[model samples]
Target: MPLRYQAIGEALRHTIAARPDADALVVPHQGVRWSWRSLGERVDRVAVGLLALGLEPGDRVGMWGPNSAEWVLVQLACARAGFILVTINPAYRRDELVHALELTGVRALVLADRFKSSDYVAMLLDAVPRFGGADQGSDGPCSELRFAIGLGRTVGDIIPFERLLEEPDSAPFAHLETISREVGPDDAACIQFTSGTTGAPKGATLSHFGLLNNGALTGSVMRMRPEDRVCIPVPLFHCFGMVVGVLGCVAHGSTMVLPSESFDPAAVMASVERERCTVLYGVPTMFIAELALPDFGRFDISSLRTGAMGGAPCPEDVMRRVCVDMEMREVTIAFGMTETSPVSFQTRTDADLETRTATIGTAHPWVEARIADETGRPVSRGKIGELQIRGYGVMLGYWNDPQRTAETIINGWLRTGDLAAMDDQGRCRIVGRSKDMIIRGGENIYPVELENFLRTHPAIVDVAVFGVPDARLGEEVCAWIKTSGPLSAEHILAHCAGRLAHYKIPSHVRFVDGFPMTASGKMYKPGMRKAEERDPTPRIPVARGSERAIKERLSR
Candidate 1:
């Protein structure tokens, strides 16, 4: 069924009203708790304040902070006021922060003053020159409507968060008119940027309907209970965390454990144990880190019944360890990108270990996943081709890039840049990105972007960025540069000029005399990657247990 307009806010309101006094957000550090009613009221106040900030409808507001109760409030307020919430990963450096804020032309920024020792306020201030410049430019960056507000610290120059509220004492708040305004099902509510296959960061504009329906459907598939405490250590900036963690929990009327800042394995363990959290919601890196802790067995993590494993492939060992070691009931495998509101397939709990460990599972309800040839024709099951998905969760399109959006979303389906295959049981398993896309610690990067930055170096002739398998990060970025004259890693890195973000920068730089090419003179990127993969000098040193198991099965 097609959702009526305002379905997202309506869902939130209905859930809040259902149990007005029920706990909505829990903060262990602050020892604070807010009921759904109170949360809604706060959201209303924030919405009213946002409207007062001179923001136009559809303006992008950068929610740049660690996960907190206020984070959820900001998102709700943005949605209610018809603002596009641009999520900012708290881990980003000053350069990254500046680019994202300017690229999206963020009208208002919701920032945390400090997370741990990292001061986001200082970072934003340093980047203010670039960000401020964008606002004045006729065709550069900032929207006509743009400004910033602080969340954590009441520092000099930055607006304090406490003052963002209009009149907290007021009931039902104002901006009901804004809420009642005509909202289209296609109006963008959020802009999620992914490093595109073409090596440009393309902002995927997801509508209110896309996000709300995706969250609701995912929760339904997982059979989330209203009483469950969903422990979320992932940053809400990412689509996985926002839709699956915050919105999904809200859709199911579940309580959210909102930690004040970025991830700490101990903090997560403590939060889960303290809250008796029923679902462990985080990336595979987080899960692995938690299990690697010496005190892992002592952390009473039985509260983590089951949850998601994606962003990067969850190895069979990781899956088994989560089930056998962490005691999770079923660790569901997922596959998607920001373009699809971040979920295309989720492994069924009933599937066998191979299916659970290997495939990304069947297409999500209301979604169709198919492996198609270059011409967009479907290939037979078990044949590798580009994976395409058509669904409600798919974004409306990219922001401000109609041509790129047209290339990505043809008709109703999204052409995911991932190469994949459907099994006999119709489960989709991702083979690789169709192009040179690298996912390092769940941050997608296109090789061309990095190569373009690298090529600007006086010492560089040509550079190619590719993914190298890593034990911890799943994939680490490796750049093979053919130097014009001569260049050291230090020299090359120094010349980056803060143009590329740290993740986008190369972790391993290999200087080569020449790169192999086809007769047409195009670089054989796969051949280069293959040669490097076969080099065998720096092995990734994966645990041999899963290797042995996989070998045994193949032999059978």
Candidate 2:
């Protein structure tokens, strides 16, 4: 298949040359739209800047911000300089930002001046002093860290990103070819931490081949093309953004349209229509909100060839509208954690409706997918087991945590901690996260079953189920629901009564308009717990969307 690149940078060089004059990126807010040629030149200049900063091969350079020209440029610069790129989420607070940066041994950081009244420069500088050698290498001389600047209104002391580009072309990237030649498929190319809703974030290490393989394989599965333009509304820090969005674009020589903000459905819609975009890459929430836009139907979204839905489950209804109403090729449902370069399973262009709508679909061509029991024995086909995968998509293991890595990587397969059942046709249906499972009175319950059942209720908008402290059963199921119309505790319990066993039924029902969510759209249960404590009354209309159906349904 003529696959495998020397490194990501080398592959990108060929892409730029093939379409040197083609518009490779469009950043409307920055008034920046660069062709592949110009983008390549800028990448080289940034590489020179990093080299001058004394970056070594395989060293990690951190970028903490949204998807901007500078964000993409920094990643490319790392590739060109043989430095591994580490992307940190911009929406993170002080502690999270600090933990991720230090955990990955980020040698240098490139940040924005300010975004939405938050000054990143001040944020990092203030957080740096408190770092206190939290694994900052007990050895001689901790790696010297510097800040490279990016977009924003102000950056007090950091070096401006533009200044780094002022170097002469001769000094810019004369050795780019040398660095590219030195890289191999196995070289650590990039690393990004998971959202860590459960525990401290672990850096997922992606090699050049792992990333490129995921991109190439997904591109083929989704039938992405060189002329296709994908609207990347998700942040580049996420696996969906980097592996499927950026790396995929590079592999297929496709154009990537970057929005000014992480999420503005209106602006995103405008960008897609304006650029004649052929695909939309986003989490399910983004698509749901976009569909909810009052003027959403007014736009000419018929240009969309296909959609890749991941990060969270895409409701079957959403998939139907995306495919039938939006005039898309069927939306492909993808599944993988940060540990798998973000794509081990993806619905192919030829996948059936059931596979596309109900399951995360089959493993990629080079990947193996299976379910196993607690004892590591493979589960029979059609039976649920812990989902495990082994392939080029599997990460190089979490960064710098040998013990944790050993724990996660068993033999060769990566224990994904996700529960799934594979059908005879090889379609993998993800049932629930292993940790999210609730064991009550010796009965096992998966929240996804309850959540899926709740979604069937016309009044229900969203739902979450978690196991809270229980005196007798060890842990009892508690359900937090967000509804469009009024619904009551009794009504929820009754509906869940027949569909599930008594132990699986949520013992407590809390009605709230909104549940806390992470930037990538996973429900933030910890934050929800905090909010529950502060309010203690989930019975009333809280968030704006709360309706009276709960009370009425119960009164009936």
Instruction: State each candidate's clash count.
Output: 0, 7
Q: Candidate 2, residue 55: CA error in Å?
A: 1.9
**Candidate achieving the largest TM-score:** 2
- How many residue pairs clash in model 2? 7
- Model 2, 276-303: lDDT tens digits are 8888888777887888899998888778
Q: TM-score, each model?
A: 0.76, 0.91
lDDT per residue for candidate 1 within 252-365, as digits (tens), equals 899888654667889989888888888777665577678778888888887777777766555455567888787776667766778998887988665667787667789888
> What is candidate 1's CA lDDT for residue 463?
65
TM value for model 2: 0.91
Give Cα distance to truth, residue 395, candidate 1, Å: 1.1
- What are the lDDT scores of the predictions, listed in order? 0.73, 0.78
